[model samples]
Target: MEKLKEVHVSRDEKEAMLSEAMGQWWLGAIGTMMKTMGPEATMKAYGPTMRQIGRDRASRFIKEKGYKGHDVMATASVIRIWEKMMGIEGQFLEASTGRVVFRNTKCPLSGTVPQARPSLEYAM
Candidate 1:
């Protein structure tokens, strides 16, 4: 009989795995919903819920980061943090008091579920 070696995963690796799994699950679920319910109906049903989730996450992020102001820079900083967390490859074209522009080159959710794109774009 052969003995198996123990394997360990680092926290960062675990987080990445979890993030990828969640993204895949969301894409699959949304794709299914869009197919069954139609885009408009699916959006109508889930749009407000998604907005609330975003607001809640933003609030928690601000609190956790101890962000003082809701200024453009602060918002941009939070966005940058989110991009990194989500494994999104992107560049900030401009981040100013008046504007914050970002171009995403790669997304964690991209190319995973093509049918979900149209519905997910609205949520995004």
Candidate 2:
């Protein structure tokens, strides 16, 4: 008989692992979709769906967080927070009443799914 050593994982480590697994799953699923449906068809199908999902999520976030203002800065703040939580590295070049500008340096999904960049950009 062989003894197995106990291994402990911290919460942050578990979250990182889960996030990585999700990114892999997303890459696989998107790649499969692009292959089977073709990029144009995939974008046509996924674009609206993802936009709706984003809208729903934003609505929920606003409601849950009791967010009031709907100005550009307010929206930017929410997006910035959400991106940080998703482990997206970015710099906000400008966020004002008129506009919000963000420059993404690193994205978990982008590096792994270069072929699906068009579809991803369409979704965003």
Candidate 3:
């Protein structure tokens, strides 16, 4: 009983906090410019967004053509591009003080790369 009480925190909680901190750092440093990667920012952020947009459209493949979105889903670099703003896609503005909260990564049961599972996107 004492051993259990002695425990300070769970590993999951620590990892979550760490991940959030990293995300905040990204935002503080370049998230603003990345979201506004428009005439107000650089072309680097643009590439990721464009890729995400294309990927989103590709998602339609499941319904339109029965294609899965697995490998593409797990790609941290790719998902992070759209994860900005909590995957709130389709707009220049988001809930984060006019700036988008970029993810650059996916979470368990959150966003998955194109997979064979039909539950992913209404499956084909």
Question: For each candidate, how many residue pairs have backbone atoms clashing (under 3 Å)?
Answer: 0, 0, 8
Best model number under TM-score: 1
Per-residue lDDT for 35 in model 2?
Answer: 89
Residues 1-124 of candidate 2: C-alpha lDDT, one tens digit per residue = 9999989999999999998888678778888998888888887877788899788988998789888888888878877776787677878788779999999898766666566656656655
Among these predicted structures, which one has the highest lDDT?
2
**lDDT tens digits, residue span 1-124, model 1:** 9999988999999988997788778878888887888888888988898888878998887688777778888777876776676677878899799898888898756766555656545644
Q: Give the clash count for model 3.
A: 8
Per-prediction TM-score: 0.75, 0.73, 0.30
Clashes of 1: 0
| Tens digits of per-residue lDDT for model 3, 12-124 | 89887888786555434443453344323433434466457566765764568664445523343334543453443333333332334332234332332222112212211
Measured with C-alpha atoms, the lDDT of residue 73 in candidate 3 is 34
> lDDT at 13 for candidate 1?
98
Q: How close is candidate 1 to the true structure, as a TM-score?
A: 0.75
Model 3, residue pairs in steric clash = 69-113, 69-114, 70-113, 70-114, 70-115, 73-113, 80-104, 84-102
